[model samples]
Target: MPSITRRRTANVGRPTSAETDILAATQRLLVNGANFTELGVQQVCTEAGVARSTFYSHFRDKIDLLVRLATELMTSSFDVTSAWKPSEGVERLADAFLQVVKVYREHAAVRRALTEVATYDATVRDFWSQELNQFTDWTIAVLRAEQDAGRTPADLDPVSATRLVVMGGERALVDHVTAGDPHADGAFARELALTWWYGVYRRPAHHGERSPS
Candidate 1:
């Protein structure tokens, strides 16, 4: 299967100045409490201090721009995840998760806008899911490696565990930022780290059976 992450402009790297300007502009409006659906391209271009033509050149539509923002945010989080080692203690993993939390908090507005837009937009929804699915693939690999190394228990199905953790962890991370409580961020990150560490990587034992599919 091809990676949704294999989409264009990915290997090309981060956005140029014009793209950054427009993305930053949309984030500003959302930060100021403007409804994302109510925001117009003209208003965004105006905020960006760029021409409407520039906006059109950079993005096909607002949904596209939101997807770009999501991509940037996910890339940062994935980079952090890549640094983590199963051999490292849960505290170390907590530190890695905290870095991810900081990334989300840094662009809390864009994060908020993307989630809101996704609710009513199928394109955004699928794009976001595909992005998470990409991470799920990476996570499954890591879990399998840990099992081979005798860290994670073999009883757990890596595929099923990866889906549950990736999807659930994505939602939890987004909600953690949305709640906007800095005080809870650390605890939340630690809890997530612990869940991944003991709940999967070091699970004691488990059992399951298949039902009609």
Candidate 2:
């Protein structure tokens, strides 16, 4: 009798349509409240209609997939806000913040998923940190230009002040979104923006009061 030998299958490195389907399905599941701990590779394969071996061929694990999805979300947000321009003094800031809130509210499912995942994932946290820093830098540039033109308070430090202002706006929106309050509207965002401006911009000295020259 002739000796029989079995050969191991070679790994083909190219991504297949099945892998794309799995990633897309995973994103949808995440948007629908399947927490990271609950997200298993098997479940993802089931949802995507793929075999277990197929998933392993594309991704090392669930965290790796989560990192990719989170990065996409952050980059998309940056793209949406890149065209932002302030029209009036503080109103511009208010409008810009409200725009962000509106976009998040419209896609609350995905936003909530990203928020929850970022809380525990270091990679997601780093992605958000970098994105937020970029946003703060952009805001500082706007404020600095206003200061140069005598629109903003001369005593304020543009860079530090802008960070504080952006933080306030960001937190206010997060609170509104997470609160899930039925009455939550653009009013809260507008108020928060105005409050920030009041602290950063100087009011003219009252008549008969000596200007602190």
Candidate 3:
């Protein structure tokens, strides 16, 4: 896993109802065809039905609000990952990945906006990179545990294997979601599961299953 250095902010407290309202309003605006770069603070205040000063009190800027929303989206998806147990079987793991895909679809608008903003905003890019790296770290831990149990290939490097799977899967999934083909998710999930299972975590062959030459 990579080390991440995060910037600290002075506004440190739980979000108020008004703050939630503002974030939700911003998402709605994005869903309705407003680009993140073009949207104004006053417009968001009007949509959220809050005074401009109230918005500032809760967030440092529009980018701050965008990062918060993106963080919420990523955390919600990660909540599913935290519960996953490899012993539960590959079918369950595949289902978990599918659930993450469902989340990405559910919050497509905000996600699309975040993707667009991340291209130009260094802060947003860092925040997203750190979040995904955390997921990759969790995956590496799982792979290492499987290796200890002899279910995974002992020769495999968990760090590289996990980065290939997690980082590669992230890009593939984002592309699939942006393509908007509803039928692609199931096929993609099946392939992804097989890649992790057979490609990295398959158990060694039993001598009993070998045929005589």
Candidates in order: C-alpha RMSD to true structure: 6.6, 10.9, 4.5
- Candidates in order have lDDT scores of 0.79, 0.63, 0.78
Q: Which residue runs of candidate 3 sit more than 4 Å off their true CA positions?
A: 1-14, 203-213
TM-score (C-alpha) between model 3 and the true structure: 0.86
lDDT of 2 by residue, 1-213 (tens): 111112111233444688669768887787677876677888899999999888766666665666555445555555655565533445565666566676666555555665777678775566567767877887678768768878667788977776776676666666687685636566765666556556665434442323332
**Lowest lDDT 10-mer window, candidate 3?**
204-213
lDDT tens digits by residue: candidate 1, 79-186:
998789776667788889999999988878887777788788887778877877778888889999988887777797999888878889888888888775899888
For model 3, how does the per-residue alpha-carbon lDDT over 129-213 read when each residue is reduced to its tens digit? 8898889888888888888888777899999888888889877777877795878787777667667766767643342222211
Candidate 2 residues lying further than 4 Å off, grouped into runs, are 1-24, 50-60, 88-93, 106-120, 201-213
How displaced is residue 78 in candidate 1, in Å? 0.9
TM-score for each model: 0.85, 0.67, 0.86
lDDT of 1 at 202: 66
Lowest lDDT block of 10, candidate 2: 1-10
lDDT assessment of candidate 1 = 0.79
